[model samples]
Target chain A: MRNTWPGAGGSCLAESITRRSRLLAAVVGLGVLVVGGGCGRAPESTPEGGGKRLTIGVNFETLQTEYWVAGFEAIRSELKKRGIDVVDSIADGDSSRQLQQIRTFITRKVDGIIFVPKDARTCIPAIKAANEAGIPVVLFNRPAAETEGVRSVAIVADNRKLTRETVSFMVEQARQSGRKHKAMVVVGDLGDANAIGRRDGFYDAVKGNEEVVEVVSEVPSEWNQEKARSGVVNGLQAHPDISFIFTSSDFLFPAIVAALKSANKYHKVGTPGHVILGGFDGDATAYQMLEEGYLDATGVQDVYFEAEQSVQAVLDLLAGKEVPALILDPGFVIHQGNLHDLKDRMWGARVMGR
Target chain B: MAIGMRVDGWLPGWLKRGVLSDHLILWLSVAYVLGMAPWATGFVSVSNAQTILAYLLPVLVVSVGLTLVLIIGGIDLSVTSIIALASVLGAKVMSGEDGWMAGNALAVPVGVLVMLAVGLGLGAVNGFTVAVCRIPAFIATLTTMMFVSGFAIWVTLSRKIGGLPAGFVMLGQNLWVATVMAVAVTWLAHGFLSRTLYGRWFYAVGQNARAALVSGVPVGRVTFWTYVASGGFAGLSAILFTAGLETGNPEMARDNLLDVVGAVVIGGTSLYGGRGRVLGTVFGVLFLALVDNSLNLVGLTFYTITMVKGGVILGAALLDTARTRILARTG
Candidate 1:
């Protein structure tokens, strides 16, 4: 005779039932925790103006880089000072999950939404959903597609122009050297609009200067360090004479350094065998590299400026004020020439407490 | 006559040996290298060889461990996440800036041990879920992967931890050291699979779990240990990656899952389990590294390289199916 009691079972059937019950309990418990946590936040006290605190939902693609982390912190802290509450979500580079997050924010009745899209096109529906719920949406650092019947304020840097300016400085240096230099360009993921803009900007700067700087290789990094390292190593092997290197993002500097070191080419700017390096998105690493005389120039996106503008745009929309659909931050290229004067303005320098 | 028989007759006697039959991908990879040499500048040079080997070390190490899990009819989708988590955790212990053991002589060793411990602990959790709790390996490992990845990012707030001690970073910069580590791991794993009773139990269990249990093979123990071994190997791979990249990043190896799985499968590891070889996996890794290196040397776009890689993997899978059918007929 088989025992049917829950604790009496050494039998398979008893074990199966016990396991099922435990699993069910766990699932139910998790659901309750999620729901309770969502509803359990302490409400902020009303301001002196006798209005309820404004709660905003901010969705990020991924905080895998310093730029996104700085931007998120800036916006969150700045909004807190204004008595605004923030609910944050990071999609970790998943567009479908980002859409779901937006839906959750809508269900929570968030007053406004700010998001950095994983891609230009797939995130439009998320904006549309916010619009349908009568919530203002602000696109941060990345713009949505120009879909008719959709409205949102986008705070973005001019990636192409800034990249062109940075590369132009690299070109000027090459011209001063009075030699034709073989070049390698490390391109980022083509799916990202910023990556595309940077790549095009690189081409724009090198268009007529082919006589001074000839691009010998285009290494596609997909914003991954390992891929960048491998691509640079292989590119150097194929073109050993490459002296000019430009990467789409500053985060790839370590990878470039490693690859160049392996090839016995890494040196100071004034030293022989030194590869002239230029990067975009001036991060702390780029700042250090520039100071060390290893990096020639970097396209510095004003993260603090962009973050402030993004929040201001959302607040303006809530105030029934008209704003332009696109508020652009015309970023500048920082090189050694003006590093001393403008170091404070570079977000990466500020983050490093330099 | 069938094309296979005709081709067999054209082959040399040594090449027709049964041992050589398992290494068809090896010969094909060699042929590929020679074929691409003329078109791809510097494809066959010594410096390029170093690049391929250095990059191949981490992936190969992880795949070697993954092969054991596959042999036991289990899947581990969390190895990449383990690499990332282990990297950051270990980096934190040995980092030059305020690390737990900063400026201490034992920092490097202790940090390495911590990485291994994390891998083993995570693996044990997976083993317990699948072996004891009866959760499917796929679902258990998938959940573990998601949790570990998220936890890693949260620990560092997605900031990269750099400034590792020189002694620790040397392991990655020295090609000879990395090569020795990778070779030793592969040799030990191969010996375990071929020369031990426990190893044989893995194949038996994978072939038919119920039958193995009836045969008193300790199916649960074998399944549990296989995942643990895979995790430990991922930890070792993490050390190499963290040292090689010279930074501890939460996003390290995020794009390497396909390479790991693809290399193992292309090496003729049966996804359904019960059969695989360490040597075959080595050649599979070499084949992929060569393809990636050569495509870049040829200046092909990333899109083109991706499509070409996908095609190659598909062809290898088809070859695996044909090889299995031939072996069955011979038996």
Candidate 2:
């Protein structure tokens, strides 16, 4: 049956948030004026530059992804440790509202803003405002789709590096097993730049490796387990591959696992055959699969490290120091042997208080 | 005898065609046969049925909501985008991934209520503009469609938020729960329209807005509430989606709106509204789920699926047109 779609408070939430934002800005401005009056200094663009106050803004596409929560908390904590004031504005995943929040941040006169833009194109206006306001930005997780001149340093896991290496492990497994042959690839939302990168990375590395003709069929699962699981079901029926299978992310590992389990791929020749399915991210299932000697391997992207690097990038930028274009490599591959000890490593459990 | 009856000015051409071509019966048989064939090639077994249903639940729920709105002659283009909004918001409010029990319990009430309110509010906007300002429902909802979809991606000031507590897993992960939700929405909506006064008004409004107005019906108010009801259902469907994902991303439901509307229309429901039953919408939804699930088993590319879906819609429209003509001639 056809169902309807719902939303949040209409004009009420909009009107209220607007008033609250304006009021908060006014209050922060007055407080700044009083502090500046006593110090007898114009707003030192970089407040923390010379024994001063600094406000850092944390802009999230929306605080809805678990990985980002730990990542953002780390950014907030690290910046706080450096004596920086953290002002976070969650857009709830609305691109326009996010643009509005960025504008609001600029109006609030924050020293620096950390943005996780939902839409790369919609980010221009907001990024421009922050740039014009002399606020440096650090992007976390995914970068703006096409950031030609957006003044931001993205502290993401070397996505290409991670996926390429993980696929290499699967290839090596197949080589070691003497079952070097064909493979199939199940993918996520093609619209996402991240998914595109992961898919291309895996295909590029695997396609030319051998005569292993991989049939890559995509279902727009969009990183969801159900959809991914369904994609696996589709793939199994479509291609009777002679080799490895790769799902783009660790989040999809469980779904791939389910698809394999249902297909009884677990029944093939002595032990679970050399049919390896790969994933990306450090989610529980990805780690568990390694612990149980499940599929092949996964590429781990530490949320905490990404967050810490984002903070460092902002600090270095503000200090007028040359910041390296660093790609933090989160550790990868969890096999049956080390699964127990890595329980706490799944999320930033020990790192962030959350 | 039929020609003689018509000659007495007792029937119009369309009416004569309707009695013969209402072909609501064909959608199910056709959808089922089409759905089963690919799966029959040793791909889709009964064990896979549960798995497919799990994947289909969220979409099914949204389709049901769209069905209700379609009957009232209103459309909710924002259903997909609103799903994104609810999923994200629900995730943000949850305690963590396993927080399904308490987290979803509390969140469900709040999320559902907010969705309901938003649904009504948005529907009111469409209804008001369409009814009061004389805007087409399609145009009004389309504007809202753009806004909600933009909101799904734009929110969070640019960060992905996730922490659904363990409790939410059961809320949507449980097949029974999802099924219950689907049935509940369809039944409530069905009851409201088929057995209630408000429902009749929807039919009356759809049958002829000017006639409905002249006949002492609160045409504008009915139209407005029709949208509100449609939106409320959208919110409910979104909440279910958050439960299913165990994490909400604002961009997740961006592809669902058209599918939901398509299901409604495919179920033998007229775009003119006031004529289709919830049963028809339900069957339409099931037929779609069958097609979608079966397509996955056959491993068709998304592009192929798109073509199939588009073809299905066009075919349904043709069936509708053909039936009306046949009924006019025969009945």
Candidate 3:
């Protein structure tokens, strides 16, 4: 009776099973191919000299942004010139994965480790593991939590101070416009230390300039362009008189531009009704906008400087020299006035083939 | 009499006739809009309406297809990933910056085709795994979601591609164009579900695959095509989002998955399958869009808005359960 049914017939059943077997084979074959391709890269050989070449393990939070990509490339190229081998892994924003990668590096007995943590506090265990393993660790571009026992060398930009300078530049521009201004601050993910520091910096710069700049809206972007666009549109609708805008990062410039253009307010700096714009991360978009007279200022993090410092710290640690617990890159604010002179120093410009 | 029957008996004739019970979300949405207008600045303005519509269109387009998948007792977690992959691939075809057909007049059409192709292709992969391999839809779609997302990021090196030709971008810029597209898609989907024989097969397959097969329905074919249709819808949504943002972003629509799924479920769609309506999904999307816009205008923090929206979805779900029980008893 079952075999007599439409889908339950013997021929149909046989064909179904055959098709399922074929699909299983295909899926398994594809998986093997992917895994094989991922493992194809060979490790670097020893240098020409007779001396044993040092191997360093570099762990990254994510390379999704141009800033992180530039930093990673700078570190790799710099280490390559000195004949050092680097084994790197990216956690892709998973703190637990970052810890596991660090442990793997410790197991491999790498001479040193440089890692950008996903979270300030969750990374303490990774640092502790490296410390116990007697491997020198360098925190690259992101500082770990201020724990009592865990120790590591941190090389990062002064995020708050740099953002304060950047926002102050915008405040000055608003002051010079000779009228009180409504402002919007596009805040990043609050969980990130750098984002919090930048938010504080905006507040710090706007503290005494209340008469010139009144912040009417704080659009929480959460580091996503879609969220940034939506928040900016809603903020603009609520407060259409907004004449000043600052984003936590430069990657969101595209979202801001779209929102402003939709509202017919995306004008150049000198144009009437132009909104004073400022951003951090000094990415390629910010550089182009500043050059085109649409952006007022951007906080430049000096990726090359940070990368060089991180590599130096690792090398110094390997030499039995005591490196500073904290290495600060006092980043500068790049604006239209200084853009021409500092174009060569800006990593964004460098990435743009300038 | 049962408690549900007693409750139904006190209601007005229209209420007892199942109008309110069937379209509860619609009434709740209307009440929300009227109630929020007084408190949220610009909540009733034309400009705010445009803003809400812009935000609503992409989510609506994606949810319309998701409604079908849910109706057939399947779920596709790869819809957002499809949007991202399609957005970037399509942008690569039509972008003014070193695009394949950069200066060509057919750039927009070709780009649209590529985006749809990516969506359909990925959807086909998902369908084959689930229908042919007999794998669970959840696991198959989840695997596709992860791989497609990673592939998209790899394709662009995590960089957003800009310089999309103005002609392609104009589709996103014009509100009327987006509205027409969304409405046409929704109307067609609604008709297919309400007035077609194949659509009836989807419900039968979802309700009981064995029974559907006994009734001479091609269960595997129906399941396969439902996922393909979903993929096509997600691809169409990618075109709107890419054009609207004026860039091909690998992370496009990454945060909208929860919204799409939540909206569908909140609109009285049964997660266990065999029951849903396209009209219900529309009201669900509208309700979410309204809440999001009003909260943003009121200057509430993102966290606060998220909490409020979660509460509203929970309330809607609870109301759906009560309404179902009451209707079953009264009938």
Candidate 4:
């Protein structure tokens, strides 16, 4: 409605030109570096299974989230040992920017690229751009847009299977505890595919286990801790009778612990030791907490390994080797007894992450 | 209708006043409670109220300044973006383990000064655009918001920088901090509204810019400064909120604009401008916070809360119109 709402910021000709030039130069320089760095030479990379020292541009949907960070770390360590460089452009689950990062990788002409897209569908244009540029791509953690030529290798903890495993394990533990304790399942982001699977899986596991009445609460957190913190706190207060908070991600467990710890009722719930906080994606913090008697059990995920496997799949494509469209396998869940066994593996991964 | 207070002959005094009243705000609150009674009774509890208040403090702080901008018939969409920028920049400044900007140093007067200056400078940009360039407040603030958010996200790069020593999250998370802030902002905003000439000028500008200008008021200057003040308040909230979260995610507080607006509106401030009190906005904020807190305690979904909020806004609008009509006919 305002005709005189000042000209657009682009009208400042001199400043605009300067900013544009700088931006353009930066972009060009980045592209050249990516091409040079990724496609170095077959001569240098001769022995020990070597080729052009490829730079695999790996963009993640927020390395901040538990599962994705693990996946990225795995890719980084595996490739680092194999002499492959990875230029990471990580997004904190922003859909638009995730696509932009992917497009940028395409423009940079990297030897190969991998991405865990934010939205399953919106990232197609970016994926198509990489395809047009003849850059091999591998998607991990989450699925691809439409699944064309991009050798998508997701190292998913097989949500459906893990959900079943998580519930089954927790139920078994509860049954063994023999203490007629009821548990409430705190799900993060109920609408999510994995969340639904876990919810259904829990129901499947505990439907017949009459000991667990499954006192559900209102307002699913959508996987946000702040949201889940309140959800759990209220869940605890209203249904002090509830136990066994089976969540979707490790991110929510920390909040659940914080909430339950604040209430001091956390000790009263679950299998007499720690509350049964079961979920997928093996976060280091959650893993440690389990060993410390803060948790009963958790369904683990190999996020970093998954990302690495996906990257390897891309390399496989480039080397004229066969690539699978769906790389599906369930990562194992480690209890207190087995958590220590993962210590060496975790330490090794941490060292490699650097 | 018979008990209507009249001033202009049979004309009611309420009619002379614009759409933003305590009664109207109260009705909105009632509507929110009633419309989502199923969800409210379903989940929210006392502890849930604590969580909501914890999140609501930063939003209320920002809204305090936002009310000022709205009072002068302007809005600042840039508050959201400013928060993101401050968060990222704060992370960089406070990155050191025990350095001047890191950990224990966050409570020092120096850190406070830096925080204020950052907020003030960001606000000044919006002020300059609306004041010197004579751009509409909406357009100027919107562009600034987009630019600031973009830069903030770019600077942080998907990382949520944490480890703020101790007490970093106190200002945003502590009940005492929230109460102190709410009281202080209320007193300050009330003084600005009722005790200041510039504040009076803002009212005049909102009511009728041409009349205010003709009567020797500097409308542009008032509009500009309001934006600056709004931005500064936003920065302060950003710093406090970043502390509360204990991790500065450039992505944090991105969706809080809705709450800020809701607080001001539910407090009985007209989005159309010219008629709303800061104190009223504070009450509105508190009311919304109460609702948000109550939602969790009662076990309601985020989606259900949104639905309740919509109903509350509608109820507020209806009451505002009703009161306006009643006053006009009686007076």
Candidate 5:
């Protein structure tokens, strides 16, 4: 279902649009050359009178999600604060469009590029295009499929560590309640490296405790709410003895809650037979669920921090400063005790005004 | 006629007639479910049936419109975007404390109407472009699809719109009601396409638009109204989808265009346009849902599930081609 995950563009329509857009870009490029006498700079790049401004092209996978939109906004706003000229393009979840945009960025002769890839594997050509153009490319949140020929710095939250911490909290809660941890694991699209790493982290934590901590079902929901709900219903029917629930992303919280309620297994922290719910992607929804005592914990991936660091990385590259090839920002775990304090710190609260 | 008998020698006359041009998919769907019984758990159970039905409802509903447009020799790529637009509009009306219809009983009905109107408006645009403006169906609908999807994103600012009224949410969450609605809608579409003069015109236009015009069939009106119905149903589906998820997602059916087109084409509808039926689409959707459900039950990975779906669509298209040729040769 990764092929149909959140922000994945329409297949036929996107390919067709990309063909047309590429031709249009060529026409626009010719016009720019005629008007500016091959200035090799976007009109948005204004001279600040102090020094030459650095123009960075930011490519987003799809601006359809609050997370990506917020992250992009943070990056743009932060860069603007530092007087950096920004030009952005949205791929709408099509990797081909993303690759094409990279070429457009290269043609525009931007100083650097920031890419949020739809599929890590489909981004190699995009990274290569930037490298061939001698523009520094910064991979944000998602890594490129093949980094061998691509000279880029990847700034992503450590999803595996986040999931391990969240899953560990769920296990600890189950053990404290003296309940055998018969858990149902709802996974996101395995096509996403972050999702796979999170799932691996869950298994890593419960590795040798198979006797006490049992994984009754593993649902690959691909981060779809309806599919996740259906999976939960089917899983509950197949394994009614399940005592805990773990989700790879907090976006599945609604589906998990609905399914749990339907099965009459949803309850507060102290209630008997209550299904201890733990999730990843600490957003406003997860915090709300946590404050309500429905969700036990969530590992927060600091998307704002990821954006800030990505902007900084691209700037460093443009400045000819040494930066790490991979910058790992392992996020924190949030529970009831810290939910109140971290409510405003979440990405949703900051950008979405949730 | 000869091919039908050759394919199923032991079948009764009525079933043989069904197995050739139209009902071939229904029989195949039945056999598929029965065959997969051994490997998948609860394939024949009531709960499993409910799951399959619920999963197919939105696609089935939208396919009715697709079937109509396809019958008239046109395609609507904007249906998926229409669903998202309608869902967001409906959710917007009913969300928040000062929201238009937050807690009122009329909120649900009004929300439903607004969704339908939005869908109809978008559909009419596609119809106008294809029929009146004479743009290629592919380019026209594709443009609308991108525009509508982009507008929806702008309206919601790419955020999830939720807190819908409880009554409105029930349209999708209530399994029994949604099932009944799907069946009823399918029956109505079948009746409309078979019993009405407009239905005759649908086939006439699809068969040959110029010839249909010579015979005094208002090709433009028929094509326009067909798109209107398609968009209206997409709106209806938005209500169901939003209700089911209890949230308005701009990407609600971003990937469903293929599913709808596949079901329609698999149901024996010619992609080049003209001959097809809603009854066949009913089985087509069921066939797809069964494949997906059974594969999931058997613990097959998503990659494998996707391959199976693609293979099924290809086989169905081939069967459709074969049936058309056989009928042409026999006649």
Candidate 6:
């Protein structure tokens, strides 16, 4: 917001013009230097070696969360099984960064490109760019907007169905207990489609049961542990008698547990005065908690399977095979009872995340 | 003149003095908190106060060093990155991953040492770039900021590192301990700046580098060391922050640069430097914390809270400017 005077720093008008031009020249020079520094030689275009030895560029929305990290790890390991090499970069939730990386991948002429977009709309440009470069792009988890020349195959779990099943299970548990249900529904960022879908799913499940199951509090966490912790603390303080708490994801369970511990209200299943903990993103850590009876149920995204499927779709596309525009992989619910059976199927079950 | 003069029967000399200029903002904040007590639920409670203090501690610690840097006519934009870098390194050593210090009892002390050392070393880089290379402070520190931030991501691979020892974690959890540490550090800084000869060099150099050089003051050394000290404080803040969160996140202190700078400026520190106090920075920290806590207690919407906070800060700055003019006219 600070303005620079044209001739204040110089004595004469001509001198000022010269100074300004020099400054502009220096800035352009710096820009060129930076771009020049970033350049690398792209490997020569080679024929696909029986579809075995191919290089794939993978762009992640972010590796800030363990879920994404584990998902990427699964995709890499699965692709490695087929002797495929992955070159991955984290966008850190920046759309421009994601776009830039995709452009870099296109420049490098990687055999195939995989994108996990931070925002669906902002990913359109990147997808279009990849398409122009004749690179088959696969959208993992978050799909981009519909656009011409951007026919990217989308691989995502059914978020709405996932939450619906998880909440339906919670509703049944509340009914079996015969207690008036008081629930605190912790939503993630509304800007995120999954968060919106999950919130809608929970509300849809509880539509006709207002008398039996009351929504006491609804907090927006933006998928942050600290904010979620604060929300839980405030919610519990406001409604101490609430019977259940539903988090948008299992990633936030640590924050929920911390808040519960501070309030002296953390309890296991079957314990008197227990505040039932339910979450989405059926991570292995959450599964372990379910086995320990600390958690009740969660919606399982099965990130590993999703990863495996996404890589397969990219491979198929590379091999001139046709793939659907919208490949649906509906997730399921894992409660305390079935957690053991389903835990092994989860990528989260194998890797412990923060 | 009377030893203790008063304009009004109830208003003492000290009270009158405290209600002017820098101290005016502090008193206003206290009054604001108390005035909102009746309307805001639990705003005046001990538990709420501790929660507020816990959040305020790290920023306050960092502000002490920043205040010094500002007083010497320099700003370290890399303070936040230094925090991230120090925290990630500390967490890596203490994580007990791959037997590198391995969550042992000594790990806590070792982690603390690593954080401080890394902070100092990085700060020295900033100092060297500015003092030795003769680069402008802003551009020099900005360059360091980028590298340090990238280094942090490289260290942690952008992943959040947890598994800290319980003993170290306890330091961040106990509000009393954090509060005491913050106050002690602030008090020491205040004493050094006000009472020590070397500390006086900061003001002399900031006010006029050429004059200070003529007076045999090593202006470059003073400038360099201030940045190093700022880096050290940033490191200390990182430790406190990580201990509190029980995790090392590259994004933890990303938004704190504004808060630290704001605290120093609001504490009556001039942008051109040469005039400020650690005590004023302490007041500034408390004032902002009070405003934030009060706004939250009243359950204001996030956008409304942000607008109100901005307005309040602007109002304070305006009042200070008006007061200066009034004093000049009267004198």
lDDT (CA) per prediction: 0.79, 0.61, 0.80, 0.63, 0.74, 0.74
Q: Candidate 3: where is the Cα deviation over 4 Å? A: A1-354, B1-19
> What's the TM-score of each model vs. the native?
0.51, 0.49, 0.52, 0.48, 0.51, 0.51
Model 4: per-residue lDDT, tens digit, B158-275?
4455545344445654556665776687678779888998778988988888899999999888877788788788878877666654555566567677778877876667677888
Recovered share of real interface contacts in candidate 4:
0.00
Chain B TM-score per candidate, please: 0.94, 0.80, 0.95, 0.83, 0.92, 0.92
lDDT (tens digit, per residue) of candidate 5 on B1-331: 5544354556566654655635677667656765876666444443344345445787789988899989999999999999989988888888744457777778878888999999999989988998899998889989999999989877875555656766776677566577677778778889988998878899999999999999999999998888999999899888777776556767667877887888888887777777888877876776776676666555443346558768876876666665665566657
Maximum-lDDT candidate = 3
> Per-residue lDDT for A234-266 in model 3, tens only?
999999999999999999999999999999999
Q: Is the docking of candidate 3 incorrect, acceptable, medium or high quality?
A: incorrect
What residue runs in model 6 are displaced by over 4 Å at the alpha carbon?
A1-52, A147-149, A352-354, B1-331
For candidate 5, what is the DockQ-based docking class? incorrect
- B200-314, model 1: which lDDT tens digit per residue? 9989998999999999999999999999999999999999888775567676677688789899988888788888888778878877877766665554533575588688778
lDDT of 3 by residue, B234-293 (tens): 999998887766668787787678889989988878888999998889878878877766
What is candidate 3's TM-score for chain A? 0.85
User: Model 4 segments beyond 4 Å from truth?
Assistant: A1-51, A145-153, A190-192, A210-213, A268-274, A342-354, B1-73, B78-331
lDDT string for model 6 (A176-204, tens) is: 78878799999986656678788998888
Please compute DockQ, using alpha carbons, for every candidate against the native two-chain complex. Answer: 0.02, 0.02, 0.02, 0.02, 0.02, 0.02
Tens-place lDDT digits, model 2, residues B1-331: 3443444355475654443433453434343544555343222222233334444566666776676666667666777766667666655555343334334457655655665565556666767787789787778878888887667656543234445544454656565666687778777877887898878887887778788889899987877766666666666776666555444666656655566677677666677776787666665665565555444334354357557857766765665555555455555
Q: At residue A21, what lDDT does model 4 achieve?
A: 52
TM-score for candidate 2, residues paired by index? 0.49
User: What's the lDDT of the predicted structure labeled candidate 6?
Assistant: 0.74
List model 2 lDDT by residue over A8-111, tens digit each: 12223233444455424432332232222223322223334666688777878755445566566778888888888876756555553455456545544677
Candidate 4, residues A1-354, lDDT tens digits: the string is 100111122123223344455424432332222122223221121113443567777777666565665566677778888887666665445433454455445434467878776544434545655766677777776664344443344444477777777778878877766676567776644324466666777677777777544546643775678878888888888877666677767767778878877876566323454566676666766666665666666776666557567767887878888776678757776666676677444422343345
